[model samples]
Target: MKKLYILGIMSVVCVFFGSCNDEWKEELHSQMISFKAPVGSNGVCDIYMRYQPDGTASYELPVIVSGTRDNGRNINVKIGVDNDTLYHLNTEKFAVGRKDLWYRQLPENFYTFPSEVCQIPAGENVQNYTLNFNLKGLDLNEKWVLPLNVEEDPSYVRNIRKGWCKALLGINLYNDYSGTYSTTLMNIYVDGTTNDPAIVDNRVTRVVDNNSIFFYAGSVWEEDENRSKYKVIVTFNEGELNKDGNMAGSLTIKQGDPTSGANIVPVGDCTYELIVQKHETKPYLERHITILRLEYKYTDFTSDPKNPIIYDVKGSMTMERQINTLIPDQDQAIQW
Candidate 1:
């Protein structure tokens, strides 16, 4: 009886194995695949770039996929931005988690996505798409969002569980910081209202480092309009200072400025000349004009340049991007 039972169990096991092989072959023809954005990164995030002469900035967005691809079968998947759900979702995901903050709402003319469609070739597991934007059109004053989602994969299955279906691009454009900047010179003979601030609007021949400027006071920067007698220019090492969410940093007060006619007058104990506050807030995509806070005092002509007293400077600045045909930030891609 035991021998007979063993033979019967073996026969059933063989039959089950045969059945699975046949079914797996059929299932392979219609395997379900899911698409996902790269891990640890916003499926969509904006990359800020320096203003270009051509007036445009560009970037690449990548989409990752999973699951088995059919043999000899190339599948076409559709990808687009789902505007319908974006409004319901919060855009400041990066800021909300740490500190409550909102991204800028950019204008419609600021960006251009090359294609609404992405393809998953025969066996390829990844695809990259290009996004082009107009830097000149970007207003640092406003915040923006570009949400990208994977809508359909006729050859695969939609992954609702992993929730990797979308990537939100947070746009933040940057200015060269090369133009003339108005200052608010403080802490001098008139700590708050004495010396009028001068321009730290340093410009360089090299287009790349134009955003940086020199802070120097040869004579006196009077709030009533003061000028330095000798050429005053200073150079220093830049420091990283990020508070809240701004592209802010500090430059150490160094001992020289070669480009200017003369070296910037050095203070007795002050090591740092300026603490730049070029933060981007809502409405401003980048810094149109930044405020410079001086942390030192120099003898000035205001009270007598030869016998100038200690003073600190701080000032307000303003710059506007006048490409005014503004509109609500729109979804760049539509579901297929």
Candidate 2:
């Protein structure tokens, strides 16, 4: 009986050790690798790969090139099975070019190869891959490296426009009644220095009724005040015209705020109300009345310093046609 007990204990120890070995083997079968670029500059090339215990693998390749003062940047990336000869399996190409020198802008013109998957070699429990790339004339000396042992989460980076203000004003006549009317101009005030402060000022303007109604809008950076503001002014004119005509207006909108630096505040959603009054010179007429309500909404807002600040403004107008009892003949003239 004692000999049988000894044999049983030996068998239990063997089974426990075998189970631990199997777990170790499974852990060793999986592998991962991560890559990072040097400091003070964007990454020119980086690659990531993961190997599973089931002989499957995945990879992500990222490439970036530096832009120059005069020309654009180029990026190239390639990945392939790890062999003595370093044969490439796939490649991705992307480029970023400079569009405007005054804006100091670099726009991304290409992007490809988000991810890929493949199977490991048959009968071979281990798998490995190679990454090769060239960035903006810079040669990467590192040819191949083991993938990071930790799993990496998917990531994405993009550039979006922000901090822009757009405003629109439209007036629709209900009936065919011809009369002279003046346009109201908008005034913009901007505080703080910017790469192009004048660029912000030119965004606001008079869009409709160029001959009948005058529009004025501009931005200015005030160093002393340390604040940036945009203003739109609408001026209206009174005159006589042949009765029977309707007018509709529209215009292009652009950025009216500073792109960078301190005191750069984004213009939030806003709306303005305009009041129009009619009066006859022979009869005294004066009253403040609401004529139109203009609402502006900016959908895209970004903190990125490279993009321009632009907003979308939609305008709507409401007119009152009630006759004025105070003035005799026709009706009272419009008042402010």
Candidate 3:
């Protein structure tokens, strides 16, 4: 009786090992093709691109094959622009009925796909779809999106999982002086008085061109529907380095819409200084610091169009951008 019990246990072990043998030999999950783009709460993947003048910048979007085992055959994944998806996404995201706030589709003139089809050879699990961008005249005021989709093919299985087959790429172009500036030292006061001041900690400046950027004037920000009226465009003109190893420059400040916008006037000579320093401990780290000395005045019409108030903004603003020399990619090198 004991011998029979031992025989029965051996038989059960053999069956269990035999069943798992076939499982490990082949993939149990479906080999579905999908995109590697990850979206945020806004349903868009924010990608940073370094501004390239008179040239094209390239971004590689990864196409992945899902499964435990290697891909058995080659895949020619057809890619196309899906504007309809972007239109529906905008409507779903922003139901506030504000068209200006909606994301705009990137025009064809700004971007081009090297190949409409991405080829993944046998035994490869991933490949990149290259998108070349010529963002020379790209407007930064409007939010831009590049929507891509993987077309369904009879040759391979497509990943039907949510957000796997589609990618919403939000393009953010950055230049040398276009970024967030620390505005704690900057003070805003009513046109006549300078005692009590209103200070904003941080102010974001948008890129206008290779050497120009625009920011909201004084305490005015994006919350107001007519915030565009207070737009202050600043163009940097860099000069030779001074004795202190600092490059001095002057800024040309202008109203975005001179005719129909807030009456903006410069109080003094608006100038800037740039300083570059290397990290003491980390030799691979480099820091670029920009200091802006500004004194400007602008009329605020959005607070109450009927009763507009004039504000006097003065003092210095600073921005520091750190670059890692170890990274090969320009976009990834910035600590932003």
Best by TM-score: 3
TM-score of each: 0.46, 0.18, 0.90
lDDT of 2 at 282: 28
For each candidate, what is the lDDT?
Answer: 0.45, 0.26, 0.87
* Model 1 stretches astray by more than 4 angstroms: 16-51, 68-72, 91-101, 104-106, 152-156, 173-336
Candidate 2, superposed: residue stretches over 4 Å from native: 28-106, 110-336
| Residue-by-residue lDDT tens digits, candidate 3, 19-115 | 9997799888999988988998878988888766764688989999999999989899999888788888888877576777788999999998888
Q: Ranking under lDDT, best-scoring first?
A: 3, 1, 2
Error of 2 at 306 (Å): 31
lDDT of 2 at 37: 23
Model 2, 1-336: lDDT tens per residue?
A: 999999999999999999997776453321222222221122122222221123222332222211122112221222222222111111211122311111111111211223332223323322333222212211111122222111222321111112001001011111111122222322222223222223232121222222212122222322212122232233233333223222222222223344523222224333223333445552344433322223232222223346534433322333333345465633122221
Residue 42 error, candidate 3, Å? 3.6
Top of the candidates by lDDT: 3
- Candidate 1 on 136-255: residue-level lDDT in tens? 644332336666667774556655565566666666444433233433233234435555444444222112222433323522322222232322333224534456443444433432
